[model samples]
Target: MSKKILVILSEWGFWGEELVGPLEVLQSRNYKPVLCTPTGRRPRALPPSMDPGYKDPPLGKTVATPEMAEKVRRLDDPSNPYLANQRSLKAMLPERPYWSDLGELGYPDERGQMKMSYYPLRKWEGYCRARAQAQQALVEEFEALLLVGGSGPMIDLVNNYRVHDAILAFKQADKPIAAECYGVACLAKARNFDDPRSIIWGKHVTGHPQEYDYRDLAGVLDPETGAMLSREAGNPDRWVNFGPPFYTLEHILRDATGPEGGVHGSVGRPHSVIVDYPLITGRSTADSYTTGEKLVEVLEKGLRRYGW
Candidate 1:
């Protein structure tokens, strides 16, 4: 059946194959992809991902092909319709208000001059209702959510509550959720306010392993300004390393999956793609195509578990 997939990309940088692999597969079947970013800006592909000679440090193999590189260039082209229009997460999703001094959570202090905004019950009820409607609208409009991986997700997608809400919406609606590389961390972090535990707390998955992470050299985005250090300022190379990664995705997945669930890595295999019911995850860049195919299987073939 023809379907629409919600694709969340990192504005900072997204690995090229992560989007192309699954996208080509899904598009072949007439599936439509709706792309969005943390902000409204177009997503850029990591330069290393567009270089046919770029080899993964651990795997010792070239990760990007010439055809894949060209595809990334096409998608990145401003004239290309694929990314010309992008939905903004900030505009589309309702953000949960900070409660410490929101005035609704407690009796007004020195700063609480506005009486109209002090009704905690009313404020909460309104937020809950809006949140529910937003989630409902999201599920109704999209068949599934696919988060493309890159180091950039470490900067934006993982802890973004709006993204978490998007995940919760798909889960509530029983739609499949797929992520590759660092993008899988979102599944590990998406939790309910009441539960506190991750949605994938007991679900097997795969993501960027600690071993695959750079030990010293890493691409670090400036937290406040989104400006990354030079490949040599704002003028730096896209995938060039600046330091060490903030946190390892594999470590996060290991703790997130808990004891019952398992985390798989492609230590010896060419690719690692795990499907545990509603969630499908890929180990790293190499597994992009497989991750998309697995999502298709979940949506079309009724497959539930795979790559255990």
Candidate 2:
């Protein structure tokens, strides 16, 4: 049987190409990739370009492909236990209502549905809920986990507890946990039971750079907190941006050892890269191919190590 690989997608739409590219790489290698979410329903993909006025657009308007739509639809089956969970689905919904809330300021909706407003960061409630659901899912199913990144992850992945749970579970299982771009933040937030600092206290991993967040012009502006979500999500002491310009250099951060001995994380850029054992990660959308390739590599190596 093909190896079972589980991919967790952000309920908020993603940058269409990011998930698709990596998924294709996995499928080509005969890896049985199963799609799951906080909810099982097909999650939408955000378009490559966002309208200045914030009008949501459907897949038809974006670079989304027919094959990609099929994969999403296949994963969307409401019958799937993952999607059927009410708590997870509710948590996936964005804190702010999509473009409709803009009223007069909203962009013209000549296309199908009004484009939903995409946020750079997720609401704390939504983030927490999804994290919970994802953690549970990882425990019950999946031999390995892959967190595909997009702007949506900026909000949901960082500082989310469920994300921490998933990483910890995989670490405990001694399975490879992989992520790319914003997904890498999941690694950054991992908790170290011994240190109280972070699970990834000493692992090299790459994420959407502070510059990338700044360039995207999509960082959070919390009316309540009055601070950017990214800034709040990161260690206040660290010089990371919650928003964009998304430079490639600072994007790869690493901490290779914890108080305990285990190879934690490594820095990677657009190119394909891998860190054997425990975790595998990539830099950006450009690195999805490498990320997928490395994930399979780790799994295969793991199988050999265990004499499976």
Candidate 3:
């Protein structure tokens, strides 16, 4: 039987192409990949930011092509058996909301229903449930875990106790794990660098550079609850903050100082891109292809050595 790989996706919005790219590579190698979300139901993709607007190369490049987007939509349709199975790419989209519906915050000036800014003031019910499901799935199936990145990650994965718990459980098992961009933020919650229990402690990994976060307006928040997206309408802040930026670099810098030291440095002058064992990470959408390529190589090498 092929090795089972579990992919965790956030329902918030557009997942980077890297998520799909790595899965494709794994399938080509005959690895069985399963997509799990907060809920077993189909999750919606965040609409392309560039749609019905300006058409540019880089923007067009990152946004899902109409065909790709359409395929995802079809998978959500009840009749799509390919998506009904656990292995379909659509299975990875998160179905359940991490928080209760808050109802429309307000209507957009243009049209469409207004969306909620934050979870309906509930503490962490939705997140807790989702985390339990993800952790249980990881334990019952899958030899490896791949946490994909997207703007939604900033809201759902970072500092969220459920995500923290899932990572903790998988790390304890010593399973091969990989993440990129906002997905890397999940590692920060694993605790201190010296704690053997911490998955990121000594591992070399890369994620959205601080520069990218700031440039993209990552952590800025609304005046009301101090939440990141409470202010925006069409786009919620949940996909922006990925938890306080403080948590992002805290564990990373500590790990970089470890024995490997100089082997891991910032990717560009601004200092993006970091890597460590059993873990491969990247900066942002720009680094998706390279990130996917590296992850495949890592998994292949590991499988070869262990005879998987």
Candidate 4:
């Protein structure tokens, strides 16, 4: 049977190449991709991603070539049929929570079980985690889950319990989980509440490096509501600090993987892609194609663990 992959995209805005690069490889190999969103709505590409000449403020270079830009534009076209179709996260939910959701139950007592006391704030975490985990069985429907990245991810994908649940399920099933650029931040945040350590706590990975991050205005849109995604919509500021200038995916991955795990980055090199079994990551937009290629190798060639 042709390989089918579940691709998670942010409703806000995804970097065009981040989606196109890996997708191009997957398409060439005839791998079927099922696009999904947090709310099951169609996702859109960030405006800047379509501009081949768009200069990255920090890198001081054009991030996308004209050829790649055209490809991204085609992929993002509403009439393309791919972006036009999507599945809802709610439809995937099952009954039980994953092992991580237990942490949110009540802070987990000394024995690593839910504490007797109640944690109102944590209740939602527990609920979301459980719902996400129950959907772990959904891994059977696809070979892997690909998290595409862009500034929009910072607004929705990060700390999203459903996304975490899906990642955990993929890990439990030993299916490859691929992510790129800011999308890598989900790994750092996908931790078992009781464990104080991230799922990548001891795994080598690569992500958006500190040097790769830059300050820019990123607008997040709620595909369901057709409005700017904001926390304090009633207030004038309305969570204006959602996307800051200094946040870097590499820093979080480095700390999450702990001192034992390695976070490789291209300081002087042109590209970076790391495959550490079940977790395939890429540095930035430059590594998107390589990231997809690496994922293909892991899924098709029985490759496991590379890219120190």
**Residue pairs of candidate 3 with colliding backbone atoms:** 154-242, 204-275, 204-276, 205-274, 205-275, 206-274, 229-237, 267-272
On TM-score, the leading prediction is 1
State the C-alpha lDDT per candidate. Answer: 0.82, 0.52, 0.51, 0.78
Query: Which of the two candidates, 2 or 3, achieves a greater TM-score against the reference?
Result: 3
Clashing pairs in 4: 97-130
lDDT of 2 by residue, 1-308 (tens): 67666676665545545666677777888876676555444554543322222322211123334555455444444454533332342343322223233332222123323333233222232433444455555656666878877655656555555556667767876777888766776676667433566655555445544434433444332323322345345636533343443333233344323444232223232253446456676656556667777777666655222100
The digit string of per-residue lDDT tens for model 1 on 1-30 reads 567999998887788889999899899878
Task: Look at candidate 2 and tell me the lDDT of residue 147.
Answer: 81
Candidate 4 residue-wise lDDT at 63: 86
List TM-scores for all candidates, in order.
0.89, 0.56, 0.58, 0.81
* Stretches > 4 Å off in candidate 3: 49-140, 192-198, 214-275, 303-308
**What is candidate 3's lDDT per residue for 1-308, written digit by digit as tens?**
89887776664543535465576678777887776554443333443321323132322334455555554455444576643354432232222343456653322222233333454533243433444455666666776777777666555556555455656656666666667667776775555323554455545556554434332333333223323353354354245443434444434544543554322335454324444555666655545555555556666665322101
Superposed on all Cα atoms, the candidates' RMSDs to the truth, in angstroms, are 4.7, 15.0, 12.1, 6.2
Q: Give the TM-score of candidate 4.
A: 0.81
Off by over 4 Å in 2: 39-41, 49-140, 192-195, 219-272, 302-308
